[model samples]
Target chain A: MAPPHDEVADSRDRAWGLRVGTEADGTEARQPVMADVARLAGVSHQTVSRVLNGAPHVRPGTRARVLAAIRELDYRPNSAARALVTRRSQTLGVVSFDSTLYGPASTLDGIERAARTAGYFVSVAGLRSLDSRSVQEAVDRLRDQGVEGVAVIAPQISAVGALAKLSSAVPVVAVGAGSRSRLPMVSFDNRAGAEVATRHLLDLGHRTVHHLAGPVGWTEGRDRQDGWRQALEAGGARVSRIGGGDWSARSGYEAGRRIAHDPEVTAVFCANDHMALGLLRALREAGRAVPGEISVVGFDDIPEAAYFTPPLTTVRQDFGELGRRALELLLEEIEGVDRPRHPVRISPETVLRRSTGPARRT
Target chain B: MAPPHDEVADSRDRAWGLRVGTEADGTEARQPVMADVARLAGVSHQTVSRVLNGAPHVRPGTRARVLAAIRELDYRPNSAARALVTRRSQTLGVVSFDSTLYGPASTLDGIERAARTAGYFVSVAGLRSLDSRSVQEAVDRLRDQGVEGVAVIAPQISAVGALAKLSSAVPVVAVGAGSRSRLPMVSFDNRAGAEVATRHLLDLGHRTVHHLAGPVGWTEGRDRQDGWRQALEAGGARVSRIGGGDWSARSGYEAGRRIAHDPEVTAVFCANDHMALGLLRALREAGRAVPGEISVVGFDDIPEAAYFTPPLTTVRQDFGELGRRALELLLEEIEGVDRPRHPVRISPETVLRRSTGPARRT
Candidate 1:
């Protein structure tokens, strides 16, 4: 349906417009079509279209004239008309769950910046749950809104299954989903990051690094655990799972209280920074000096991580880069590029800080 | 324009439908209109409308028949049709800046939850800058996308001015903008929160509290500073201005390094918890014992605050409540409720933790 007349008036008032050579009565009027720009520039409609579309083979003088006409007419391309013609909305949808979390939130911020830079509007569908039904509904809603492509920040196992089952024609990119999925995905190298963190502790002369894992069902947590186990086995150190956290400080504190009681636990690796903060508190209360008696490390160098007591030695994920690469992959699919389907894995860098030190002499 | 045929087919495959009454040829067909349900139910169209709208006065038996017919026909109320008839898109647009920050991010999460609970979809236009042009463009973009109302999370001073001058017909509620503007707003009591944090430090027997202010131009920062000054003046204590932070840990650390040199500084209040974390780090590195040589406090008891070194004593702003209230006010304006123009202020409470204690006996 055509937009209401008032909406048109609102757009006219806000849009940039110029009073160029105008009507037969010598009065300036609104220019609503490409023909008006072509007429004012004394150029053919095909020339104007070529200029607008950046088509090759246009003369410099003709291109300059078309540009001048566009500016003079204050002619902004109508997205609705363009969508109708090309069957594209030039809009990307982001389906994010629990965006308040640092990982998801940072990823989303990156996606928005990248999408906007590529001249696309981002419509976010925030889901309250990671259930398959909720994921499917959110995708359907975005599709109904005419988004040409979608980026799903699906961090959970169930969400990956839902993405595989989705039948929408719109191209989809799943952020943070493991590389096992059939859909295009961009993710931080969780297992590799964890391996580096674990190796850092082993290099410090610690016998083994006790793991405080994130909750089950999260691909990140599972991958991190796998990396930690692999590092321990390769180092010929005993692998012991102290406990896990729900990626919350309270849960970390609860798990830390148990780990603090074990005299053999000299080094600990937390899945994320928030849990590391809680572990620090529990260790301090238990009279264990950070890096003096026990070395600690965490993942996701969030903004506050550097300010943690003694500063956290953690792995930093370049969420912005991850988000940008995700958009690039999604756009390639949207633009119908027949590229090979390979997941993009962004490497994480380990940041050395006061939180990790050489293990105490036996 | 009508939605393409494939979209309809996709919806048909997923939508709930069951064959019941048959046509003259004894075959069930697609039902796309309310009249089809009414015909199958042997009821008037008005009765079906009343049942769908949950309007009172429909007989129980008639309502049941209409509901059954609706189920059998898979009569999903079309949002486009409803929007055309009622001029309501059932969507709320949120204009947010720096959504990666804890306060703005939390507020946005809250608003999304509240909007979803109200059966509305949230379309977020995340601003890259708080400039008037950017603010106006975001609002215009959302309006063009057909949001029924808007919640502008305009914490910056210039954004409030932009919101005041907005000419769009859609109703707007400015969240976190100071109450000085003509538009309705919902905000955490920044002044009260700062006042309480300052008073807590002063009441701890400190001669005066040094302030780590947030950057200028943010109404939240300005109000927090005002509250801190008011508390100091009310207590008849000397006020000293330490350096300010840009609500970032790096800035806070830079400011903290400067504050650590002053021998007279016994207590300090940071604008937010992230900055407080930096302050703690600086103090520890300077060998100043927390709550022994100096006491510290902060505003915005973010989730990680309780796990900070020694746990931070801070003011808690209910960002979720603020967002929920902002949606309520915007919805009221959208529904044309005759209400006063006063802004809504959500109170903040001081959370006492290990970060603050009695000042040292100098």
Candidate 2:
């Protein structure tokens, strides 16, 4: 059952440890193995294992001796050898859109924090797209590196077949991909957020709300747009043809230019804070004062949202909670706990600020 | 040298593959090993290996049969077996400050793109602090997981002793850490960027620019403060006491509130975009018009800068380039390439927009 080439790797591993030890400790020419610690402490290998694992059977004197031996030798148990013993790499992988957009970036930071708290190493694969081929490749690459589970933070859940195939390979939890798929997912209610924004504007006495939507392809954009439309229709208001942007401030500004001169448009709900900032600028340039001449609402209360000239009223998504819950679900799946299949959805809360107000007298 | 427990893992690997194959392929209940493909194709194991590795010297017909056999049996090479053969994990690690801040997040995205292009998996370790003890712990963990190299994107370059110790364990490249350390670093010229911002305001006829600086502990903040002071001295303008923020818009707003009513402060340069944004809000609240009564400039042209009410004038750092160059340096270190010892420093550019104008005659 032995692989012929393993001898080469084994020799290389020994040489690597020795070389590192020589340079690291200066005086020490070789790394001390567990056996060395066992010998120094006059303990059996099982006793050392019990001490290392924090198992209860080791006497206080024996534990103290083993710890002293370990400190004296500065021995670090080899990761590969640990994997060989436990069949766990203690590593998780994240595949995300390779963009520095605020939402994905914050979620990633959150996931990393959660993983560290849960005692796992997190690996990441940045994909240019969430197409089937890209996802397939990214997952395969992570799996090849021995990741125990994966968290995918991209929005293109339309690539359902590929994701379905991928989950069979490893435990996976989706974040922000919407709850469309049967896979375990932790998502923010983008639709609910948009609805709340639209309703708030509507309650401010606006006849109708113009929607500045995110790019059409994003699931978040689609859900939010749906919510906006639903709220408008429910309020008996006319639905203006939606203006779209790629979630950039510039694009929002451009969309604002078109809406600013339209005397009939008194209210707007932007899909994200950056675009809302741009829209506000365009309105300002057109001599339209926020919440006076026009009322504006945005989504995702990014750190800069409150600093906008008039201060933005936007949806607050707890990305930290989303990440923590995603990790919880991923770990559960990895441990093979048979829980009922229900996607975890967090409802976003609306933050009221100066940007939204009563419509001006016509 | 054989571990006695390996038989259990080996059997589990086989069973795991079969279960996944049954679930993934439906029709195929057993996952095909390389030997199965070889047997079906009537080729030696070496021939199958050659085909899998894309090595030359197999006849076209033999290659076709091997491909057909691979397709028929749905073979996926076992990762552990592959590790035994090559002894390379093809993974690189990144240790970063666990923050959703613009700089670190963007740089991390850049590193991930570069790593993927270079055909490597990127593992991440997010530390709450870049202190000496935390770094040593993180690097040790990554080393245990068999990362070929690490890119650290945090600033406490003062942790020189611990970082110096870490290099012996693995190849590492530091990003944003000051050039003071002997370790190779990819850093933005924070001082130069600050100088450009201050000089731009000074050139606009502002006698001196009040600085709204980031927190003092950050290397970027300290360097920026130095550059601001140096620029004022060179221009023969009296340097005022600097205001400080925590790199958040809210902090900037508070600093702005203190300065908005000051007749002596006609111009202000912030250390980062978010702080500048806060400053703008505070000025607006105080009825001070941008470029009319006061002028403002900021560093780090975050995506929303251009959409500001008066589009922000700022210094732009190319975080992508910073990440890419850091990865290049790390790869060089991993490959043991002999190179000059000087660190790589990228100069940021000043992006002028509507925010800055000649100071109003006092």
Candidate 3:
């Protein structure tokens, strides 16, 4: 939404306040390509293309016409050749999905901050899907702009593979990507965080914790579920599993409601904080008392977690740390330093809110 | 945060599932700038700059020498001229701060999505503060990049003034900015959202409602307090305001605990939902049964809102909508179309959850 016209006019004084430099107009007029001038001047296409590309063999009078024609028409040179020669488009291409989800957006902020500090500009391209074709198309566009390097922030399992191919061509970094390839990568320890949450519940004397996992295709979702399963198996507790969920609070609520209504469920761990929030509501509506009958724990101690009714007990992953480390690894690679191939794991801490408690006396 | 190398490698095959792109030689030679080529060619600096810019009028011999020098040095002309002719960089600069707060991050995502759809790339510059120097420096850097326009997501009152100065030279749209200036802007009706939250509590039959606010300098903070004050005045009820907080759950928890310690506080409308979550915990700790004793309503129906132990009844703003609208307005201005200057106020919807109820009769 924009402000009214009159307000904009009034604020025009405020508007022009900080601009520091101006570009020359004469230089812009001469930017027309040789082909454009040649077409206007009635020359062969190759002749015009040669004139624009600065071929030295053009006839003297023909060169004058080409120059005059170039002046008459305004065209910008192809960005590709310019990018190839300058080696500094001062731009960094960022490939990501158009998502309202918290993780990707936060990582983007981190990437943008890191890029700015390094004095480079950012050009973002969003992916419609993690398929190879979509990834390739986006990559081609970035390459067209002649960006110095690229950063892919998609968490889909396929993205790592898509990125592995891209890494050998350009300096590429993947946020929340697994450490499978030799290409540099950075991500949160999803499995460890989930394990911590599950173990916390078990330590409180809960028999076992049920899991509501994120979509299976994402590494974070799978790792978290694995962590939950690992903890349950380590404790010799039965592992009951629900099939799937998108990373949404509503899905969590639905999953939570089902767990609450079930007689066998005594404790539950949600994949992320948003889902845990939903589950909490579902449990309440089912006439269950949190922590008293069904102890619940969540991941990603988002800002809202502490405000949750019982204050959610959840594992907190530092996304800022994830981003910083990713940038560090990428910069190191960019500077031609050889870092270890092993993935650097940053563990999340458990925030003990009032939501988790000992099992019922049944 | 990343996994072990073998795990990432295995995941890559599962995700990408195809042979990686063939590796091309990553060695691309750097191009020389006009400044460097001019020195080598022994021509006037302007002649070398002009020859590279394709400016006519250089003699055949001089032009030939310049061309030879350019080829030898692999000279690359600066591509900044796109700004002069089309007056379009096809890029929008986004200035923001590092915040996981729902409003700013959501707004950022919305803008990015909208910008991508408009065929414009987004360059984000995340600042740590909204101080005059910080805002000025950020805007300056974007201007240096020759960005056609910019969108600032800074909401601090201090930024309002700093950004007001920034809009004149460059087309800028300030999102979640203060409305003190006539500069093109997009923001939510924080006052109205607060009024609605407070009125909802008042309509629930509470004699009086207590308020918990965010930091003092933010525009949202001020607007919410104003709305709370206006609602109290309209109801002819005495206002009881307590502890101020930053927009964090921990801060909210402290404020909530303070409010819970007060026996007379029956109804509370927190400035934002995260804080409301904290209040719920404090109330529970104080042994006050929600609705049966104390009632709470929050603002901003964040994803986690519905998942609160008792679902949270709060006001929700569509960040995606706000972001899209802001971009549309900026584009309108960028394209030199006449646009109104009145700030667009998107109404926030009240989401009814389980957190609010009729006040108990004492």
Candidate 4:
């Protein structure tokens, strides 16, 4: 078979040795082939191809000259067969937002680690926005790369609709996806985590808890809000809905400042730890003492969470598990098994930090 | 031209619809080719090829049946052209360690975002340790994919040596890499951050500052220790080094408790915010009040840093900048530009939180 376009081009360049080449100049002398390397290295063409592909059982000296000849000839292996038996590009495509938010970043790291452990390459694409077009474009680009599998780190609600339009030609596992997705996914149980944080505050004897949530469109926002609501309803406590904000410490602080002004709000559950940090700042500025006059709880026990004053009482999401599971699902698809779609769900655990305490007497 | 080995297999599987057909014999039948899909869909083979390759100008109806036949035949495109034009697998390989530390995770996110923006696929390989053999094996696996470029997120001292072995084959960029690497690299300025943090306390009239460093073997640990030493020496203030710990809150707390018991230590600078938090807990337990009796400063102003009781005063590394810069460098290499080999260092800024205050009279 003739070499693919890239290998042919590379081999042609290698044949030139030091000759300049450009796309417009299509005519070029072809480089030495497997036959040429075999002739020089005193090996069969099959042996040369096997050495080029790093097939396990070659003799040591034969491997060396073949490698030297490859270095001299700059022989490039055919990628098509490599993708076949391996059933992999050894590459993972990660679709994510462009922001530097803590949760997405952590999840990306875990995904990278898991993929690396499994001996796959990782490529990342960023969605400029959560719009359908942006997501579709990202997916299209990843598909064009001949990726074996894709792990989407999209957290926006729009991602679900956009991803649904994606071709299921390859296995895709989404992280922080909406609860309703048919695609295999791995995510932290946000709703349960929110409930745990809320109950911890309520158990501290606070009459009611104020809630500051992430943007309503995010899956995390919806799930955390749901958990907080369910916890409040279960306790028969009036759920005072505070207005929404973005997932940032600055937003949390703004929301926290607003809640601090209300005399009846003794405890509050912010959607994430960053927001809680902001809320803590606002509460302090508003002359409300943490765990003394007011208690606060946060979610996603980020690395910096426990360092917050009164150490944040928050929930921890095992991002590593999410990353590992997402890769596993993608691999399963690559392996071409007709296994039933088994979506993996990881639960969040709450850590008792110093941020929550018994409600102060009026 | 024949496609690269991997692409050929992928295309073959799709063209033949290997997933859809079965054989009465134990051996499986190859999926039908584009010729079959074209025959099945009542379109020319050229039209079927165009539809499969996503040619932009195809008519909707014609595109639809061709696509339907594609779903029916599962025809896949030949990877020959892609392999030739880009000399790219259209895949990027990333190697990282297993820990879920905040900095590395966030940096990975930034790189992933950038890779997506550039229209490349990502594959990740995670290492259990930063040993030479493991890193080499990981690199070899990535090389087997014929990756055009690679990014390694190794933060340990041993990782520096491992990267040298990976330098010859691909355009490798090391993230969180030490100064010793000759390969192009991007990293945060840990030393400068520590100096600025320590100086802030000294400016507040502290005679000396105690240190809580990360594990000694890591680049971060070494840079931070050097920075602290340089600052104390530069200020002509007393310096004391405490036994180091990992970048965790528990370790910080233990170090903090030990420091708090020594009345001479009035100000402390921790390697990271998590340790600062632990230090705070230890300080409280030891009856040393924050800012009143002891002042503290930390690095990596994570979101929860502001929520730490009295809020953590720390240094903030712009991870977004780090990610963007790394991407820019990688692209430059891919574009074959002449670039300087100096370590591109990003300066971390001091975030003034409430954790540090003026020193009190003894």
What is each candidate's DockQ, to 2 decimals?
A: 0.21, 0.39, 0.19, 0.23
lDDT of 1 by residue, B1-362 (tens): 12323334332232211112235663444435788888999998889989989999999999999999988865755454555456456777898898888887788888988887887878778897879889998887877666778899879999988987663345788999975777788898899888988988887889999999988888988899999999999999998889789888888788878878788988999988888888888888888888788788988899999988889899998988988999999777666565567889999999999988898785
| lDDT minimum window of 10 residues, candidate 1 chain A | A12-21
Q: Candidate 2's residue-wise lDDT over A1-362, tens digit each?
A: 11122234343444344235444433535456788889999998778878888999789999999999999978777666666457688889898884488888888888888898998989998877767898888887888777889998878755555677777778887888875777888899999999999999999899999999988767888889999999999999999855799889999999988988988888999999989999999999999988898999999999889889789999999888888899999887787665677889999999999999998777
Q: Which TM-score does chain B of candidate 3 obtain?
A: 0.77
> Which candidate wins on lDDT?
2
Model 4 chain B: lowest-lDDT 10 consecutive positions = B1-10
* CAPRI tier of model 2: acceptable
Instruction: Estimate the TM-score for candidate 4.
Output: 0.78
Which residue pairs collide, candidate 1? A1-B1
Model 3 chain A: ten consecutive residues of lowest lDDT: A21-30
lDDT of each residue in A97-133, candidate 3, tens digit only: 7445667667777777777777677777778776767
Task: Please write out the lDDT profile of model 1 over residues A1-362, one tens digit for every residue.
Answer: 01223223333232221111235563445534788888988988878988999999999998999899898866755455555455556678899987888877778888888887888878778886879899988887877666778899988888998998663445788999976788888898899999999999999999999999988888888889999999999999999987889999888888888888788989999999889989998998898899899888999999888888879999999888888899998887665565567788999999999999998888
Off by over 4 Å in 2: A1-32, A42-50, A54-62, B1-71, B80-87, B157-161
Quote the lDDT for B186 in model 2. Answer: 83
Q: What fraction of native interface contacts is shared by candidate 4? A: 0.32
Candidate 3, residue A209: Cα displacement in angstroms equals: 3.2
- lDDT score at residue B72, model 4, on the 0-100 scale: 76
Query: Sort by lDDT, best first: what order?
Result: 2, 1, 4, 3
Residue B142, candidate 3: alpha-carbon lDDT: 78
Model 1 alpha-carbon drift over 4 Å, by segment: A1-87, B1-87, B167-169
